[model samples]
Target: MKVLVTGAAGFIGSHVSLYLLERGDEVVGLDNLNDYYDVNLKLDRLKRVEQHKNSYNFSFVKVSVEDKEAMENLFEEHKFDKVVHLAAQAGVRYSLENPHAYIDANIVGFMNILEGCRHNQVKHLVYASSSSVYGANESMPFSVHDNVDHPVSLYAASKKANELMAHTYSHLFNLPTTGLRFFTVYGPWGRPDMALFLFTKAILEDKPIKVFNYGNHKRDFTYIDDIVEGIIRTLDHTAEANPEWSGKDPDPGTSKAPWRVYNIGNQSPVQLMEYIETLEDSLGKKAEKELLPLQMGDVPDTYADVEALVKDVDYRPQTTIQTGIGNFVDWYKDYFKVK
Candidate 1:
């Protein structure tokens, strides 16, 4: 299958692209190479993709999803069998500062992708949603079937909007769309803005790391490989209309059309302090600690109910936080040359 993976230079996107290429799929990776974090990291990820000399199934284009015209052109050019839409302006705290970026990238950009998929005869459109959508809900294990009307941050709101937009497209055009609500995805080549990266960096630098919510927060930190695996499984399993779905008691997770949502998480929520301790152990350095109140648009905890995902894909994320953080620390030390 030929796949078009947006945000291919990004942390998850880069990993997904390589996974697809490894599985003998021709992948066209697209990214604007935004400097939201560091363009150098994005370039380095792209370089890693280019380093695969055997399959040569990967190609990248410099483009942003917000540019509707360019996005349409790319879609028109490639008859993508599957689309993994992973690109977005992704930071809860940052969203509070810059809401328009979320609107443009997460909202407008997603609109363009839905349009493209609707018109281009794409088979399956698997997009990234977030655990942040479970904002303000103190549910022990967050499920896709739960109502997500309340979003704490603009980033979460945009993700919820993407799910709605995809549902609309699926209902209107019969597009097979699946939204994966990822929970705290982390691993090698991870985003610098994410908690794992920040904790690793601070520990290596011997700087104090801010433990949010007084270190009472818990997160279902998922590994990148697990996410990529789930994505690949979902991409192959096209969405189908739930025949039993009724408007009288509609399920939020499934639509009458070919649309579905699943939580791609490990189903294991670890304490923030435990995560810090794991990093400290991995790096052989104790991090200076500063307990801080939870910031705006931030949730105290995130625990994903991945039963549906497992039932659908016959797979569950197996990487523990310790292993995941250890891999990340090793990668960080090797990548940054932290002696």
Candidate 2:
């Protein structure tokens, strides 16, 4: 199968691309190599993908998803069998600082992807959504069935908008679209902006790490491998219209059209302090902690109810925090030459 993976140099995108290539699938990876965090890290991920000992064809293109002309040309040229759209301006607090970035990347970029899939006859379109969409809903174990009308940040709102837009395309064009609301994903080659990476770096450098919400937050941290596995499984499972769906009682997760949404996350939610401690243990260093109130666009906790995903894919994230943190620390030490 020929596939197009946007954000291929990104944390999750790189891993997913590698997985596809190793399985003998032709993959065209695209990324703008933006300076959201570290361009060097993104380049390094691309290098790894290219150097992987895989039998399949793999290529990387430097293209921004927001560019409609480039995206349309690429879609028309490749006629992709499947597309994994993971590119987006990610970060809750950053969204507060630069709202326009979210609009350009998440909203406009996603529109191009939807259009590409619609015109190119893509078999399946699996795009990234976020657990942040469950904002302000004081519900434990966030489920896809739950209504996520209230979003605290523009980032969350953008992701929710992507779902809505995807539904529209699926309804109007009969395109099969699936949105995966990923929980906190962390592992080797993880983004520098993420808490796990920041905490690990700060602790190793003997710098103070900020404890958000006064160390009261709980997150369902899913491992990178598990997330890639879920993505592959869902990509293979083309979405179909839910016959039981009704207009009178609409389910936000599934629709009468060929569209569906599922939460991809570890069922376990770990306290922020516990996560910090795990990182400290992995690094063999203690971090100076500055306990602070939750910043704007932040939530106290996130726990994913992945029952629907488990029922459909017959798989669930099983990586423990200890193991995941250990793997990350090992990778960090090796990648950055941390003595």
Candidate 3:
């Protein structure tokens, strides 16, 4: 199969592309390489993907999904069997500073992806959605069937809008679309803006890490390998219309069309402080914590209910925080040539 992976230079996208390439799939990776966090890191990730021992028939293109002409041309040229749309302006706090970035990247970019998939007869469209969509719900274990109409940030709103847009395309064009609401995904080659990366870098450098929510926040910190596995499984298991779907009591996670949403998380929530402690243990160092109130567009906790994903894919993300942190630390030290 030929797969199109947008944001292929990104944290999860790079891993996903490598996984596909290893599985003997022809992969066309695309990324604009924007300076969201670090363009050098993005380039390094792509370089790693290119240099992977298992990589074969893998090629990358520098393109932005927001450009309709470029996207159209690429879709027309490749005619990809499947698309993993992971490109978006990521970060809740950053969305507050530059809301238009979210509009341009998450909204307009996703529009182009949907259009490309629709026109090119793509078999499956698997896109990245965020757990932040469950904003203000206060649910213990966030379920896919629950209402997600209230998003706290423009980033979350854009993701919710993507789900709605996917449903529309699924209903009208018979597109098989699946949205995976990812929790706090962390691992090797992770985003510098993410908690694990930031915390690890700060702690290693003897800098004080800002403990948000006063270290009270709990997150379902999922490993990247587990996420990539779930993505591959979901991509293989193309979404189908739910026979039992009812409009009277509609489920937000599924539709009568070939559309579905799943929360890909570890299911086990770890406290913020506990996560930091795990990282400290991994690095053989202690972090100087500066406890602070939670920032705007931030949630106190996130626990994903992945029962739907388990039932459908027969898989669950079981990577422990300790193990995940250890792997990340090893990667960080090796990548940065730190002692």
Return the clash pairs for model 1, or none. none
- The predictions' CA RMSDs to the true structure, in order, are 0.9, 0.8, 0.8
RMSD of candidate 3 to the truth, in angstroms, is 0.8
Instruction: Tell me the tens digit of each residue's lDDT in model 2 across 1-339.
Output: 999999999999999999999889999999999999999999999999999887349988899999999999999999999999999999999998999999999999999999999998999999999999999999889999999999999999999999999999999999999999999999999999999999888888888999989999999999999999999999999999999999999888899999999999899999999998888888888889999998999999999999999998898999999999999999999999999
Query: How many backbone collisions does model 3 have?
Result: 0
TM-score of 3: 0.99
TM-score (all chains, Cα) for each model: 0.98, 0.99, 0.99
lDDT of each: 0.91, 0.94, 0.95
Which lDDT tens digits does candidate 1 get at residues 186-210? Answer: 9999989888888888877778888
The alpha-carbon deviation from the true structure for residue 115 of candidate 1, after best TM-score superposition, in angstroms, is 0.9
lDDT of 3 at 148: 97
Total clashing pairs for each candidate: 0, 0, 0
